[model samples]
Target: GYRTLRENDTGLNGALEIPAMRRLLPDLRGKAVLDLGCGFGDFARYARAQGAEQVIALDVSANMIDAARALTDDPAITYRHASIEDCTTAPAAFDLTVSSLALHYIADYPAVVQRVFDSLKPGGTFVFSVEHPVQTAHPVGWVRDADGNRLHWPLDHYQQQGARSTSWFVDGMIKYHRTMETYVNTLLDRGFQLRHLAEPCPPAEVLQARPDLEDTVRRPPMLILVATKPAKRK
Candidate 1:
């Protein structure tokens, strides 16, 4: 729904989403997992294939929920139409929570982060990815040199006259970006331990095949964040 499954329903986006989840959560077997922004439930399907005991895919789009229900008959998989900020109806129900290529669209990201923290069982894990702030720092349109060589842009290239303006190409969709520090701080405040934070650097083979956007690809286009809910101690 609001997760932009339509904008990124292509094979390439699918290719990117699957591997990213595998990297973030290495051992998901027999775990109760929640897939937020579960566009078409692709990642949920992948988690089941990886041997997750149960998986619930939630999105804000009803069309996506209905379409996902029709696509597969796997009894262990369930799909729901709900926003991340409203996902705490059952607190601490999941052992793992994941949202891929999502969260950037949320204007109130701290609330979303808090909901995710509240949804996980103690000792549970949470992993998610979103467009890197660096991507936002770069200008929307890059310039090419006469020799067709691209010049590297400045760190604040996208900042115009000390005011940052957001650009949306399709139908004025909303996007909210937080700095790296802001992201980390939110997790800490929610009692989540930051375990791993990375920008996916696809395998060299994938890059070699598509060299058109080498410059942009070299930098972090998407940032992966991993955190955990601590186990209860008596």
Candidate 2:
């Protein structure tokens, strides 16, 4: 049902995330790619179209893998049903590793980042997006007037980090919360060289399509990053 459930992302992902990724991603021609937490293989298919020779699309959900496999007939793509935590790949096996909007759901991001670092070839690229720390900093929601007009958003206990349960397409979904420092520092600690960081904004065309999303300017909903695995030293 992710295919049907994703319509709401017209502005957030379609406008912001996708554009940011296209700008950040290095050329993928003939690259061996790993897509961690690949939901329905949309991105994997895109990687193939971008000229990647092989792509492994891994996800924790069996249903999601099934959906991806059904849609992907390309011999270049392989769908694996596995959790990011348990999934394993040989060292220097891939030229690129990418994940989108999936890191927030992972509790042990540090370990997973290390895993990705190990999975990539030296000098390989890693790009991913997660819910912005500002958005994950608290459970607070928009405070609206009696007329249901927006008053203001509230923030509290931002320094506290842990699991947050909120309803979305599914009820009682759990997402992990971490500060931006934790995200950036852990990648550096694990030996990645940071390349780019982005708090993406919807393009004018996106804003024109959905004027209500003007509120995204007040707060960013996502954070995107690009990093590189260091090559072996002489």
Candidate 3:
């Protein structure tokens, strides 16, 4: 379902999230990469194209792994069917670790951040995106006027953080909600130096092509962040 949406290249992920992620990502040349919640292996392929020496792509869904495997031909990119919660990595294994729009689905955000920190080599980078807190704070959809025009986004329960269920391609999909403070502070607590933070809006070209995305400018749907492990002091 995500593959279909992404391949169509018409959704927010393609038009907004992916572009923001690419902008925040560092150079991949000859680096070892780890892609958490790799989905259909899109980032794995992109990393290889950017000259990453190797990529370990992991997804919780076997179907996603199979689809990715079928689409991928690069021997350097390995696909594993494993949940981010359950998967284990050798310490300091990757030069770059990335997760795209998947961390919100995980309940233990702090644990994941800690794991990512431990899995990175000293000075390694971590870049990831998640559903913005505004959207996740209350996934009650939008407020509409009498003519069914979107009036504005409704935000409530921001201070309360925990599980929230909302529909996507399917109904009752669960996602954990965390405040912006929690997200940034978690990385800081885990010894990551914050590099950049972005709540990206669709670019001009994207808005010109998809006028429906005008609401995104008012309230961004995705949050992209970059943090790096501190290099050991000599």
Best by the TM-score measure:
3
The TM-score, computed over Cα atoms with residue i paired to residue i, of candidate 1 is 0.84
Worst 10 residues of 3 by lDDT: 1-10
Candidate 3 lDDT by residue in tens digits, 1-234: 666766775568788888889988889999999999998898999999999999999999899999999999999999999999988999999999999989999999999998999999999999999999999999998899999989899999999999997777755558999999999999999999999999999878878988988989989898988999999999
Which ranges in model 2 have alpha carbons more than 4 Å from their true place? none
lDDT tens digits by residue: candidate 1, 30-106: 98999988977878988898899999999887888887888878999989898876765589899999988778777
What is the C-alpha RMSD, rounded to one decimal, of candidate 2? 1.5
145-217 in candidate 2: lDDT tens per residue? Answer: 9999768666766788889877666655678889989999999999999999999887788788888877777
Candidate 1 RMSD computed on C-alpha atoms after optimal superposition onto the true structure: 3.5
Rank candidates by lDDT, best first. 3, 2, 1
Between candidates 1 and 3, the TM-score winner: 3
Deviation (Å) of 118 in candidate 3: 0.5
Error of 2 at 32 (Å): 0.8
